[model samples]
Target: MSATEDPAAETADDFPAAPPLPWRLDGSARLGVFTLAQPMEAPSTVTAVAARRLLVFANSYRGGDVSYDALGVATLARHRHRVAVVPRHLWVDDPSIRRAGREQASTPSDPGSFAWSDSSARIASGQASVELSWHVRTRLALPMPMTFTYFVWDDGRLGCIPIPGRATGSPITMRINHWPDHFPELAAYESSLALRLNFAMTVRPQRLIDSK
Candidate 1:
């Protein structure tokens, strides 16, 4: 991951006028591995392995409205790109959060519906849904720091942001069941590097990068 942000992309676009400088969020996430689809970011280099992620925010009511934010993400390998794609840009449950995300981070969103239990969860999209059930054995639990750069798109401008945070990661084994036709991006994955986390981070201001 890139350790620092580009000064040029730092203060560009409408990010300076976003709802807030940084949003403090705490949640749990599951990262799953899938088959690498052909024609990746780079044509010359051969690569394998891809990531699909699921995240849930039980409570994010800084303003006093209980909004459950659940997201489905496709974390594609960026080859050698400086700006990487991270989670929370694919599918989301809350419309309010969607509106804020579009302006703040250049995120494209899908309407979501969710249901969950202690051991199982489901996130429903338009016509497709993802069902996850896990019998998890927490082998490790430690304070972890997260650092990643996200590249997003708005109109024609490519936006970027660095999200740095701290969390306690509890890894798990999850069984995911889905139709192949619906989610071709992710293969039928029973387990991968999955984590249940309690995290807190102040989201950084967005940056619009120079294409050339």
Candidate 2:
């Protein structure tokens, strides 16, 4: 019997896992634009929005959502407050991770924040939520470094966050099963490249930057 056929067969434990910078993640992500829509959802706290931004979606064991990061995507925010909606979580587990997110990392005060399911995938906070379905197209590859920039908006201020990581995985296509109503900026379109990844990443300390 196949794992999909057997509900009990699919578990993150069945997938690859690294130390996690103290948090190892196994999940699928989409790195594409809202093809049909632009100016995707910007956290409520962000300044007046213009120009569409890159869209990203990921459902991981750690949990979080995306933002208008010109370069990197913050697909790892589990604590959904109400801003760039930036995030952090725990194994709270990895080494590169301990010093990695030392600046702005945070974990869910409530365990329910990161729980989706064995048969399903999702991550939710107060103002945001994303449900995902992933289809793998390639095999896992050797680990490599990945760097991204996530725009963070919090406490009425916006900043740029630099994230560095090492990862390896298969090519994947993702389907969005659900999204929160507050995030009506993105029109539903399923799947895109990047990878279905096994990785450990760290969020460098952020610097306050003006978003023009």
Over the full model, what C-alpha lDDT does candidate 1 score relative to the true structure?
0.53
lDDT of 2 at 45: 39
Best candidate per lDDT, number?
1
Estimate, for each residue in 143-192, the C-alpha lDDT of model 1 and write its tens digit.
98866666665565655677787778777776766532434344336654
Give the Cα lDDT of each candidate: 0.53, 0.42
Per-structure clash totals for the candidates:
0, 11
Q: Candidate 1: where is the Cα deviation over 4 Å?
A: 1-18, 37-67, 77-83, 86-89, 179-182
> What lDDT does model 2 reach?
0.42
User: What TM-score does prediction 1 earn?
Assistant: 0.71
Model 2 lDDT tens row, 1-212: 00112223333454343233333233333343343254433444343233343345443434322111111122322223422323322111222222233324322111113444433455554445556566666665767666665555535465666666667766666666775554434545564344555555654556766443
TM-score of each: 0.71, 0.49
